[model samples]
Target: MKKLVKLMVFIIALYIFLEINNQWLVVTEHVLESEKIPSSFNNYRITQVTDLHDATFGDNQQKLIEKVRATNPDAIFITGDLIDSNRYDLENSLHAVEAFVKIADVYYVLGNHEVAINKMDEIYIALIELGVHVLPNESLVLERDGERLAIVGIEDPLMGMETEEMLNIALANVPDDMFTLLLSHRPERFDTYVAKDVDLVFSGHAHGGQVRLPFIGGLVAPGQGMFPKYTAGTFTENDTTMVVSRGLGNSIVPYRLFNLPEIVVMELKSK
Candidate 1:
């Protein structure tokens, strides 16, 4: 019995040690094939970074910026949670977004934190000044080679508004023939996007369950309870595909186990 107890303690200690250390920020590349993808836009690269929560990577997010620059994406998408309301760092978050603005066409949507903290107005104004396109429950047309695509961004559902109606109105402008992309904060609400017939969705709020195990996936997420189904990776339903990022920063629990920070690079193909 004593030996078993000692082994358990050792395992626990090792787990904690691993959680605090070795948080390597790795890039996960995904290739998505779609018939709707424009011929001129084939092989278009999109870099997604989410759940920053005011965490700094190197001096003033230099390391993160360098990695993004290396990717040379056609556009950068920030799903949500640029700053944590509970532990706010305005400068770091704004600076990071500012740096990103210079790199690519930055498009963003709010996560729960942005609403909870009541900084959406201020941050939205700031982002606009930096040339970052902040899409709020609307679709924006992206054109290349005379072919057009639609990207829709929605406000997080934490604001106690009618989601189904709001989404219907937001997506009303997108034509049936055009390829569509959605920037939603919550991955758990993927069903909503699928129901709306959106082609692709990008989200980050689960934080990769805050801690993950190999094969087991994520442990727990905010909206989804223990062993949440939509914690990480890609989920496809019908014609819609949802890409959930493990996220680039931490919140609430303040640590990640086996789940390292990541920047998701999605390569869109005209298959």
Candidate 2:
């Protein structure tokens, strides 16, 4: 009995150590069947980082950034939760922004936390200053090697900022031959994007339930109840593909088991 107890203690200690030190980078490549995707864009890479929740400059974040940079993505998308609260250290947000800016073309959308903290404008301005494009009910045409793609960003729906009319207006000028990508903070309203014929949607808000359970998936997600459908990874509705990142950080709950911090790299392919 004594030996068994000692072994169990040793194993527990090791598990904790690994959790602190085990920085993992999960890569997911997605293929969207879009008529607008040019043949030349057979494999355009897009890296996604979401729900950071102020986990910056730490070993996990550093490792995640390094891994993302290594992927050599054509563009990077941050789906929100960049800051935990306006009360927490703003420096962490700066750090997180700087890290991504150094790698690829960074784009972002606001999350509920930003609105909850009532610092959305401040955070938006700061991120824009760092050369990160803040896409809130806005659209930008991405031109690379003579190929044009439309990228749209919508504000947080839960915050009551998302407008279907605004989204349509943003895409009004986009030609039918151009591929469209939408960045939203929540995955709950995927149907709206699908109706608009959006080729891909990237989001992260559930934090993969913050603490995923074994075999059964996530236990609970904020705003979303137990076993949230869009907790982490990919979900498809019609022709639209939605990639919900597990995110790099945590909030309300600080520990992750089974679910590790994720940095998604989606490679867009032409059909």
Candidate 3:
């Protein structure tokens, strides 16, 4: 009887700990240096928020906003999955974006969830009204000290378009010598980004494999399957570097094990 009681207590304790871990926000900072990065843009900080799935972090997303504001980012990027398709709630997710736009220019690209919701027009209009740049297979230039840097964003492949074709369209006019930063929702397409010769990329979709394990990393991801690579952190292939956010919130898998929600703060350095 005592052993059974102890077992119940242990299960309850583990549940509480995992719940806390889920809501506990952690900032992962990365300093990316590349000779291609313009000297004028050096030390430019960017805060990335991904895979929110409409999960609340403090009232009105104050906790997430405060954390991003604390980073003092020059730009804020929302890679994808701001809201969950399973439970559509754009207003709830926008609470963070409302605060984020006030802190810095917010750039966003669609994720699989958003595409599945089939309300791209509504979502785009809402974000645009809030002063967010909604990039749909397009490129925008950020000029600093008369030096040009391209920021390219593409639609999620779920929109019935192949990622390679999308990249080709987005990069059609971008100069070969230009330093390009691509915002893509799927990290599984890292090879495609590298093939396009993109200098840097920001992506999130794996959700840190939904459940992480020590040494083995993310246990499972949507695209990468079991023990997938590109679940989190920085992955480099040749000259292209990709930073994948572990992301915030949960969807189908209601709990995250040993995987704390994360906000990636990246600073660019001209090497």
Candidate 4:
């Protein structure tokens, strides 16, 4: 009887640990430096919130908002998967964005989930109403101290258009030499972003491979399949650098193991 009792206690403890890992939020920071970064924009902070899947962190998303506010980001980038297609909860997801807009300029792009929901119009309208810059195959310029930095966003390829074609149209007007930042949903397209000479890219979708392994890295990802690359962290090739967020919420998997929810806080520096 004592042995059985001890076994039950161990099982309960393990369950609690896993639950905390999934529910708790953690912040990860990275500093990126490049000569292309305009001097005026040095020390520019960008807080990335991705793949939320409509998960809540505290009442009205206060906990999540506070985390971003503490970072003092000049801009908040909502890479994609803000709402899970499975759950399709726009109002719940927007709770975070509403607060984010008041903190800093909010930029967003579509994810596979948004495409699957087929309610893109409704989602776009709602975010735009809340002062969020919904960039769907669009480009805009951020000018400070007489210097220019282009921000380009593309829709997920799941939206019927090829990713490459969408990128071409988006960059048609932007100069080749200008410092450009691309907000994309799929990280598997790193090669395409590099080929286009994009200076930086922010992406999310893997959900940190859903389950991370000890040294083998992420167990699986959406595009890359088993042990997929670009699950999280920064990747650089040529002049292009992509930061992949593990993301904050889950989708079909329904649970996370070892992989805690993460918010990537990136600070840009001019070399």
The estimated TM-scores of all candidates read 0.92, 0.87, 0.97, 0.97
- How do the residues 145-257 of candidate 2 rate in per-residue lDDT, one tens digit apiece? 78778899888765664557657766787776578888888887777878887888898888887667777788888777888888877888777889888887777776777
Candidate 1 clash pair list:
none
Query: After superposition, which runs of candidate 2 have C-alpha atoms over 4 Å from their true positions?
Result: 1-23, 57-61, 162-166
Predicted candidate 3 versus true structure: per-residue lDDT over 21-113, tens digit per residue: 799999999999988889999999989999999999999999999999999999999998999999999999999999999999999999999
Order candidates by TM-score, high to low. 4, 3, 1, 2
Task: Return the top candidate by lDDT.
Answer: 3
lDDT score, candidate 2:
0.79
In candidate 4, which residue pairs get closer than 3 Å at backbone N, Cα or C atoms, i.e. clash?
none
Q: What would the TM-score be for candidate 2 when compared with the true structure?
A: 0.87
TM-score of 1: 0.92
Query: Candidates' lDDT values, in order?
Result: 0.88, 0.79, 0.93, 0.92
**Model 4's TM-score against the true structure:** 0.97
Which tens-of-lDDT digit does each residue in 1-271 have in candidate 4? 9999999999999989878878888999999999999999999899999999999899988889898899899999999999998988899989999999999999999899998988889999999999999999999999998998999999999888988999998898899888998999999999999999999999999999888888887989998999899999999999999999999999998888889999998898998
Of 2 and 3, which scores higher on TM-score? 3
Candidate 1 local lDDT, 1-271, one digit each (tens): 9999999999999876864443567889998999999988899999999999888888888888888888889999999999999898878887777889888999999999999999888888988999998988988999998999998899888767655765787789889888998888899988888888889999999999887888889999998999999877899999999999999888777778778888999999997
